[model samples]
Target: MRSSVVQLAHARLLIVGGGAGGLGAASKFARKLPQNSVAIIEPSERHYYQPGFTFVGAGELRLADNQRNEEDLIPSKVKWYKNAAKRLVPENNSVILDNGDTLTYDYLVIACGIQPRFDLIKGAPEALQLEGSGVCSIYLPHLAEKTHREIQAFKSGNAIFTFPAGPIKCAGAPQKIMYLADEIFRKRGVRDAAKIDYYTSLPKIFGVEKYAQALDKVVKAKDITLHARTVLKEIRLNTKSAIFDVYNAEGKPSGETIESKFTLLHVAPVCRPIATVSECSSLVDAAGFVDVDPETLQSRKFTNVFAIGDTANTPNAKTAAAVSGQLGTLEVNLKAAMNGKPLGSKYDGYASCPLLVGGNKVILAEFTPKGPLETLPVNQAVPRSVSYLLKRYIMQPLYWHGLVKGYWNGPTTIRKILHFGRSN
Candidate 1:
């Protein structure tokens, strides 16, 4: 085959992803800019509502129902390049595409999200796909369905779930599936036969103190074992055992290891920035996240570049709800930079995680970097069925029609209204 020729392209604004954050920004900016002035470089044809994967693992929702064609969600005026970003040349405000094309932009939005590293754990990738291997994950669609199967077929023995050491897309998902599986086992009359254990690298169940206190009660009430400061290092498939590296109070490896056999293993894999951005040393930090101003979402090195979602180095929970809160701040600051105005807007590091402790109960943990920023008048730390209903029924529609369409900017407004204008 003949080598393809490289062509140069230009856009007034360029977005480097087609996920939730990128798509939402495109929907808003396309209407504000000249027709076809904005471009999105995304290789995937299908887009998945990743937050729904947890419910899918619990057999509460189907994976297909949460997915849509990427083209369907893209704005009409925005140009979509069905290709991946090969290289980022920020010095020249350009990106090289996988198809031997180059795109230069006046302004750039980097929203390429994180990727799962199943290979980090020995035998995990293959084990997840093996028939009746008793191993599964909720991060991928196929693996999520397999998670349901594994949970359903679990008879008796050690059912182990793990949370990775580093930052993952959704920190709460690891325990969420475990809770759901607990309920399933109870309903199936296998609860007594099963020995459920949770191993997390974090010191506590959750980061926020308010919610962590609530989660502690939940684990105690359900009689589920919690192992803190433990990380899943490797999986032994032939023996169906897992090796964990234990960490002590000093936050270093304690030179201790735990090997446990499992009948069911649900893993939340370690996640990091996608290769395209992480490989660019100048554009990212030591931790492999885009080096951006945490409050303003603007690149520290390149003024015209900004980042959103899991790729950004902001100190917040990497969840879709965090993206919703960041959208307004990112839009305002990006517009300010374009117009040569002072960038005044700031992100409060607000993130929400609906902690599903059971099939019908949820604890809505909403907070900022400072502390809890609960929206409702009631105590959000308490598990409630109403919160579960909101997560189960209302959030999906609101995500598709509101957030994806660029209309929803999170619950800042609702919080104020519900708290009589006293809350953030």
Candidate 2:
């Protein structure tokens, strides 16, 4: 056993993930403190840029562009425990790893993010396990490889896309792929043979009223069927059919169980924070998400703990762009706490979702916590090729290099300069 004197330096700060938030947090802390003062616990061999999955599904970007080897991303000075954290023992100021190793820290940052629960939808896991089930998803990096093949080969019959009944990273992703499928079919001269449909459990096409109104128009104009409050019940890949339950908004049961034959089915599974975090009911909210103040991104219970990315219960739409915003606030507040000072940092609740509607077009949705109506000066509601270029090529690199390196602090500096300090 390692000696306690040399075990962990008392000033040690532990970050629970190696993803965007945890990486950014650790990078900032490493720059602020001594070499032995920080440690990061993560199990993944590689880190991924999740937002790129949208473009991957559209066949506009390759999955290779979004991944980074693990060793390269983590700061060299900080110690890394290559294991998942099973429980956060904040009372002891320590974290228990899956390997039974104990790590004590003066501060902790949780950024494990969300896990996609494909099993929640009946038959989804088993059916997707098959080599070629005509079903594909863009949620996992490895699975992103199969999307292009499935989409390109879809020639006729129903091409269906689904949105699950919960918060998800990049809320615009579900319909984005549907729009891409529509454009693809039209280009192949098989638009008439393809019955393109979008089924969402949400009440609207998009979350913000302005964006939703705009998207409703686009979906109608594109001839893509949109059904709300409809949930996928099962995937019958062997029979080339899917089962769904449609409900009326009034809580009245609609007896309609949809049975559709599909040549292609794209699903975005319902997601939740890893079960380990969710098990601690006090740390999470009603939906099993880390409960943090919308502005500060600090946990209500434990002041030392801060959360970012999809795992946090902040009302803002889950996006890496939002994590960029939260990272700055967390860094500032954490520094303040360490110095025995007050936390004056506040997040503007800013998040942006790049909706890749087709090969070279995207609808950029940027908004804040107060409301989703506010967006950038550009045509925020309209689909444009310019936005696609930024999202597909520029954003991923910006995230991995600038954001993770603690150089990018959201677009606050840029937004402030643009708004003349009038906007939040």
- What RMSD does model 1 have? 2.7
Candidate 2 has its poorest 10 consecutive residues by lDDT at: 1-10
Instruction: Give the number of the best model, judged by TM-score.
Output: 1
In candidate 1, which residue ranges exceed 4 Å CA deviation? 1-8
Candidate 1 C-alpha lDDT tens digits along 67-153: 988888998788888889999999999999997788999999999999999999988988987979999999999999999999999
lDDT of each: 0.91, 0.80
Q: Model 2 over residues 1-424: C-alpha lDDT tens digits?
A: 2211235334468888889888888888899898868888888878888877766876777888778887687777677777889988777887887867778887878898998889888888876666567798888876676777788888788888898877777777778778877887888898899888888877887778777888888888888899888888889877988888887786343888888888889888888899878887768888788898878887899888777888888888888888888988998888998888998998887888887766577778788866653335566678888888887778987988899888788877776676667573
C-alpha TM-score for every candidate: 0.97, 0.93
As for candidate 1, its clashing pairs are none
What value does the lDDT take at residue 364 in candidate 1? 91
| Backbone clash numbers for all candidates listed | 0, 0
Residue 249 error for model 2, in Å?
A: 2.4
Q: lDDT at 389 for candidate 1?
A: 93
